[model samples]
Target: APLGISNRDFLQQRKVIFDFPTKGVTYMHFKSIEHPEKPLVKGIVRAETIISGYIIEQIQDDPPITQLTVISQNDIKGLIPKYLVNLASGKAPKQWIGNLINGC
Candidate 1:
């Protein structure tokens, strides 16, 4: 979910690889779960993320070389316009990646 967008409950797990290599995983799975606290929304939109850990590449660049693949989807059921939802869905990946990069 986007920052400061809504209150959501989710579970995320990371698998640590022993003797890490140039290519390794930092997370395993993630899924939305039943909210235990009071949510700040009228309705709930279940979401989950499927990630393919990055692989370090033998390339030199100003930023860095790493491949991170993510399969994320949102099941927004409401009176929102289809086009608007589609547009937001398309930008989700970029937003996630950008957040990750900026964090590092």
Candidate 2:
């Protein structure tokens, strides 16, 4: 039910939402290295197609590293814009951060 209308898939007719209860656990939030700006995309982690799923972890803000967990992986193909994904994957443009804060 998290699906909604957006410019990304408005004409493609691709649903941003996937079926619920991804994997054995339900994802409350997700942080993508491929879409850092799109932080905490709320949804369920699918049971299948895990390799491309999200990795979950709790870390201290001070030092940043902590216990990392692969909470769930999702098929967020069209959900996250490719530009944001590129940013998340480190292939980001020079103004990625600026663009993120300023909104794409």
RMSD (Cα, Å) of model 2: 14.1
Expressed as tens digits, the lDDT of each residue in 14-97 for candidate 2 is 122232344332233423233344443344332223333223344455776544233333344545566665554553223444
lDDT of 1 at 23: 45
**How many collisions per candidate?**
0, 6
Top TM-score model: 1
Best by lDDT: 1
Per-candidate Cα lDDT values, in order, are 0.52, 0.36
Expressed as tens digits, the lDDT of each residue in 27-99 for candidate 1 is 3344444455644355454444344333333354667665555655545543556776788878867887899
Worst 10-residue lDDT window, candidate 1? 49-58
